[model samples]
Target chain A: MPTINVTLYGDIAQYGSGKQLATLDLDLPQDANIGLLLERIRLPSEERGYLFVNSVLHDVPGLNASHNDPLKDGDHVGIFSISHMWPYQYRQGIHLSDTLKAALEEKGVMKNTYRE
Target chain B: MARKILRIKMDDLSYKYEEVPSKWAKWGGRGLTSNIVAEEVDPTCHPLGPNNKLVIAPGWVSGTPAAPSSGRTSFGGKSPLTGGIKESNSGGTSSQKIAKLGLAAIILEGMPKDSKWYVLVITKDGVKFEEANDLLGKGMYEVDEILWKKYPNKPAIIGIGMVGEKKLSNAGISVNDPENKPGRYAGRGGLGAVMGARGVKAIVVDDTGGPGVEIANMDLFKTGRKKLTDAITSHDLTKPGGGLNSYGTNVLMNIINEAGGLPTRNFSAGYFEGASKISGEMIAETVEKRGGGMTGHGCHTGCIIKCSNIYPDEDGNDLVSPVEYETAMSLGSNCGIDDLDYIAKMTYQCDDLGLDTIEAGNTIAVYMDSGALEFGDKEGALSLFDEIRQMTPLGRILGQGVKATAEAFGVFRVPTIKGQSMPAYEPRAIKGIGVTYATTPMGADHTAGYTIAPEIAGVGGKVDPLSDEGKSELSLTFQAATAFIDSTGYCLFIAFPILDIPEGWAGMAESVAGVTGQSITGDDVISIGKEILKVERDFNTRAGFTAADDRPPEFMRYEKLPPHNEVWTVSDKALDEVFAWVNS
Candidate 1:
């Protein structure tokens, strides 16, 4: 099992188990993606929000399948409810520039390209 | 169908209609106002004296249904506050009303010799000046209520509060919102004081029988309108359930706070422990639990973003409609007051007293720094309102603005640029916005160039908030784009969708082209925006402003904001480069 640091912002703080930026050591198996992380955090299903994995925004995948990108150890994740307007709309789900995307991927992080 | 300009010569209380000059034919809103002020008014004249002129013009698409967000009006004059050229824009039904009446701009010139108050009644028949001595010294809400009831036709009322009558440097002109609430304000610079100097209390515009906006190409207008409506409704930020629609701009509280840039307690700290108390989420929840309050209220018709809200008290009575992010932060955590209701009351007081909330917030914070009162003193903060209402000597000084308040007590940490008070964002933590605050001709106005979109909100493109790398270009581009947007009568919120969605930009250009028959391309927007800034900068230059006036306060460069523990480090060479292209 590996641990990760997660932070909640905007309205998601209400559902963050009464914590905004706490190191929640999650006991999850290897290759666990954002879907499993969501399930562990117990974010209500009705609520819509955006995810930022290692400072790169990620699109919410479809219900039938999970965008289970392999999560590495020490990856930082930020969860913000949809109530929080996603300001970086240019990179809504992914950075368009190949140069930026390549740089993001080089840092052991997934680009916001993978979606259902 | 020629649009007329209503020119009111205040020195003689005579008015006449003039043809819109061919040179100014393509201009509207900020573009029109800036040109009129620069061409006519003496830049070196006292802003509230006989030589200054006030020009009020609507955007090109204001009355037209071409853009859902197109209803903004611009008020421009030499600013008594910043002592430079100023253009303040606001959203309300009044702009559309004025546009429908086929008037391009209402120019108020000269000053009255006597204190006899007057009201300008503008109907489809003609303009009539009536005595309004009975209405002076009344709150804006009261004036609106009385005039709106007397008119019975729900005419759009544009007036000022007692602060303007008192000629306070920070006084703002108020316009009625969609609900007839005098809540919308062209609320910067001291334009209201300019209007007060003309002895005009209010302008009631009724477009009941007037011809609507003339469009050159109706089919193209429809096409462009459809494209823009689709873009605004589809974009994640402008559509329903989007950030602005769901939580208003106040949603920025946590994001900016998370980015470690939200100014607290007079910019002393970057982070406030009590920020969440006044967060958009908390306001929405409080409004939900209390009832009578609405989360998504539009300031004007066709405003789909609905970023405004109605805050209610614990008993479900309306306290204030539209507590904006700037007002929330400036009066809330920025003043060390965490109580949302208390902040709402202060917002109401500012509106009622005709003071710019951003300026009032900084002035109050300076009072705290001067040991007049302690931070988070709810009673003390509330007492400041009473003092202002009564217009005591101290109240009069505070009403003058942040610079006056700072000088009164000899406080050095005055967070201002070009005499105008800074808004909610702390410059040290958000370096890109700091560059904007330093370089914008409008003097510390965030809306002049909202680099926050990219720096913190990540709207157009992501820029590191703490870095100075590409900020000058970003601020320059945003300022140019914003000037054009402000000219089009479209709400600034439209930028969120149009910034990333190319179709949205094309649609805006198409809308202007269709309405004006001018074939405006995207490149044309850039040139037009740039031209407007140059016009403003030229006026300011003639008014004696220089490169030294373009930088933020000395404290911003010296004092380090917490959380990031950074000071403003943007070079002056880059600051001067912001307007270099104007000369080129």
Candidate 2:
């Protein structure tokens, strides 16, 4: 088993420690991915707005492409509620996970909200 | 009805109405102001001297009912802070009021011969000047209250505080919001000092029963307005209960912090441990917990994407109207102060003092870095405002802004570009915005060209925030687009949806065309933006600014920021390439 630090923000905190910001550490199997971690925390994928794996953006609300990203020991995951948003200009040139980069490239253009 | 230009000569208390010059017939906002300054003002003239003139103008669609969030007013003058051509705009009732009064622009010319300050009252009849002895040396909050009570109709009030009256380089002009709170400010480049030096304390615009703004094509205007409205209302970030409406602009704190570009502790580092405490999530939570506060408050009437908020004290009393992300970062994390209440109080103090919050916060952080006070010294930080109010010699240096304060304290790691302090974003961590900060005519401003959208949010196209590739073109595109958007009197937030939705962008241009009765396309918008930039750059060139001025602070090139440990890697040639179109 491996432990991962998780911080939940906004309305999604109810799924964790029930505070505006909840930071907790969870033990997971080595084979666990982001999807399994979300399942363990009881946070539905549809309810999450932004997902950050160790300060690098991995998933936006509608663009859920990082579920298969493998979790390592001591990985930090930050999740926000649907009300949270990261506007393009403010976050321009920000670091992104490889998973997110490929997903965004497939989508071609970045929008405030995404639909399948 | 043709809109009239109101010219007030302060030298002898004279006024005249001039017809719109045919060359400038379709110009408004920054486009009009920059052109007027370039044409009429001597480039080498002192910003606070008699040779400098202050020009105020609303956008083409301002005061029209069909356009949402089109009530922005621009204040232009040579900035005492940056010694460059500057146009700082704010959202309030003044833009709509001035437009409804059938005025295209108001030019304040020549310093007054008399020592006494005067207030200008603009109405349907004409302009009247009254002595402002009673209102002298007052804070903007007090001045707004006095003017509101004295005036018959609920007129829009524009005034300055003691900082402006003293002609400090960091002072900003204050405009009263719809709630009569003097929190809305044209808060960059020290334009307030220009207003103060001209011996004008305030301008009251009474548009009651005045001739309203004339719309040339009602059908086109309606069509464009509907498309824009739909785009704004449907966007997840701007629509009702969306990110902005729920958290206000402070929402950027966490995301920027997460991205390691928050500029914590005077730009010494990229991350702040206490960022979450003062973030948008915390602000929204506090607003809900504290009963009297509200989210989604509009700065002006008819704003569909309401991102402003009213922060309340523990007792449910109003603390501040908006504690935005830039202010929170500057006054909070940048200074190492995590307390939201203190940040709100500092925000209120900046509003009342008519000081640019970003500059003031950076100055204090620089002072803290200089060993004057410890980081997160709440009481010490609060006491510095008293020094400014009392006009102590030390206070004067702090009020002059970050560069001045750093020089005064012999600190070498100053985070400024072109003599103006950098806003919230740390340039080393985010290279694209670094290009924008270096190249914009307005010194170190984020809103000048917000590349963070494509780099971070993937709004237009995805770009790696850490990569330096194609950053020059990214900044150039955003800068030109921003210049055009600023001219339309629309809030810059519209860029989010418009960038993603083609119809929204088309609607923006169409709405302006409908008002001016001119055919406008996307190409026309880009050209107009480029034209404005040319006028401003030409003025700066004449004022003795060189390509050297369009580079990042020397410290940025050498200092490595943390979390990423990256230095400003954009090439000098790349920086110059941003405005390569100027010479062409």
Candidate 3:
């Protein structure tokens, strides 16, 4: 079985809720697609957490779920909550300006591309 | 030459207005409030008892149309949340209005016996106590709208929210800025709760239709104001070109997050992964794209640096920035809330309900940690805020502040010191503020000793934000210097630029005296600040709180923060050194 740590956004980091992050060690065969991991994690049901691997955000099938992307051993699976700028509708706080948004989206911020 | 001391002794409603004997006015602001509070208030008394008095005063350079000078207001009161002295300040329309009315300070003493309310309206004529029961059970906006409608023009109002009305320990006093938004708060400890216990709802000071303030020389005042405004306009921080003036403080959400000091999720993590989504840049874009653009408005009159915003809905409905750092961290990161709108709603509710955003955010986080509520449940958080308004038995305990909430639920992982909820910065992460939280007369206050200017921004040197080297001394210097700036009634943001430039802040005393005609100097500023510190310390000492009670929570020492894997291991010996310095 492959094991990895997962984290949810601070406001709702625990399990059993929408927008939650969790890491489940997968025992599925190497040939399994990304959809299998999405079925495995409960985050989508709660709409609380986003799924990511390493740094790049991915769908429920989990990272390497794409046919073009393949999971390797010791791969890190990461889950992140939506940023305060999520939904792109309520960014009235600091760092939510349009220029910041363009910069973030350009850097694939919501897609988990920016680290710092 | 003007009145300096605004004294309210004991529980009596009778108050005295006296001058600070010329010497103290030179050291106005935090220097003044701390001195007065320490002299008049028993530091050891019950924070909510009859002994504690809430003191509100404008800066030394107030009343003049001198750029950012008229915006700042200094507030000091015994903290119901921290169980020690508390001082919180804000930039809003109220301070200028108050100064214009020819009052130096407004003190609220004595708790009213009734469940009724009284509103203090200080006009040019005199102070009028208007019965405020009709404005009862109202949020800040409702009160603002009513008062704005009734008074029409130049009605600068400060009021408490529902949280204070119920006497919750984490309540904060709310004031409307130039934007007429009740989001600007004198928030930190539960000062509003204290006002609630005393049955005071609102304080409105309007100089219009009243006598205007007296200036030493109108020509000199105009020239002084123009010079000051020009200076502000030229400086990038306060200038029109600055993002702060254009976007207000909402711009810091991403910057602080990027800096890695933004507290996320009750101090369990350092760099919230969802930070990019909530950056200030994103907020401004959404405001425009969603057809709701309200940012960068004035908090006071004749202020060029308008760092206050009025966030509106698609239909132009307002939601306040009760959405500052404390609110962002407390409601957004601590509670697992990734969405900014949800955070803003909770923030607005806190302002309306008379609750401290930080405390309320921390309270919800505690509940999430204890299994009482699920994380990321926006509705649940909203419900908790609503429940607090009903004042249920459980709600009352929650309303008592984060410490009480954690105590009631038997949760030991709470992040509080001296019963006050820690502000936006993680102590283990920042470290120096932790020392201030423990030592400053005001319990667990971050601003009392914020080293961020020198440490992170290099107002002095490029001090490392993360390292522990000389943090104690750094915090000490920050506290003392900040007190001096605070007393001058100079806005702290101005202090930011001053601290940044070489020897910029050093000339602050002369600049203040130059404006106020008080003839103060640098050496005098230092002594006055020290005097203020001594008074605050003596107040705490008389209140029976010894050095033993000044430590941070034990968990901070044992529990290692992730990313850094560091605990608060700064020895008590080191902390004791600060107390000795205070005595020395």
Off by over 4 Å in 3: A1-116, B4-27, B113-115, B209-237, B314-316, B451-467, B502-507, B521-526
lDDT of 1 by residue, B1-584 (tens): 77889998777778888899999998999999999999999989988788888899999989996478888999999998998889999998789999999989999887766767888898877788788999988998899889988885788889988889988898999999978888799998888999998888898999988877889998888877887888888876688767788778888786566556777888888778777678787787788788778888889988888888999998999989788888888888778989999988998999888888888888898888888888898778978988889999988998898889989998888888888988877777666677777877788987887322332222234433223355667677778888998999998887766655667777888888888888786657766788999999999989998899989888877787786677777789988888877766
Q: Evaluated with lDDT, which candidate comes out highest?
A: 2
Q: Any runs in candidate 1 off by more than 4 Å, and if so which?
A: A1-39, A42-78, A86-116, B450-467
Task: Output the lDDT of residue A19, model 1.
Answer: 31
In terms of lDDT, model 3 sits at: 0.62
Candidate 3 per-residue lDDT over residues B471-551, each given as its tens digit: 556556666666776776666666544433323343455556555666555446545565677777777777667888778
Model 3 chain B: worst 10 consecutive residues (lDDT sum) = B450-459
TM-score per candidate: 0.89, 0.97, 0.78
| Per-model TM-score of chain B | 0.97, 0.97, 0.90
DockQ of each: 0.16, 0.51, 0.03
- Residues B121-226, model 2: lDDT tens digits: 9999988999998998799889999999999788999999999999999999999999999889899999999999989999999999889999999888888888
- Candidate No. with top DockQ: 2
> In terms of TM-score, which candidate is strongest?
2
lDDT of 2 by residue, A1-116 (tens): 88999988877888886657788899999899999999998888778888888778888878889999999999888888877766655666777888888777777654666744
| Fraction of native A-B contacts kept, per candidate | 0.11, 0.49, 0.00
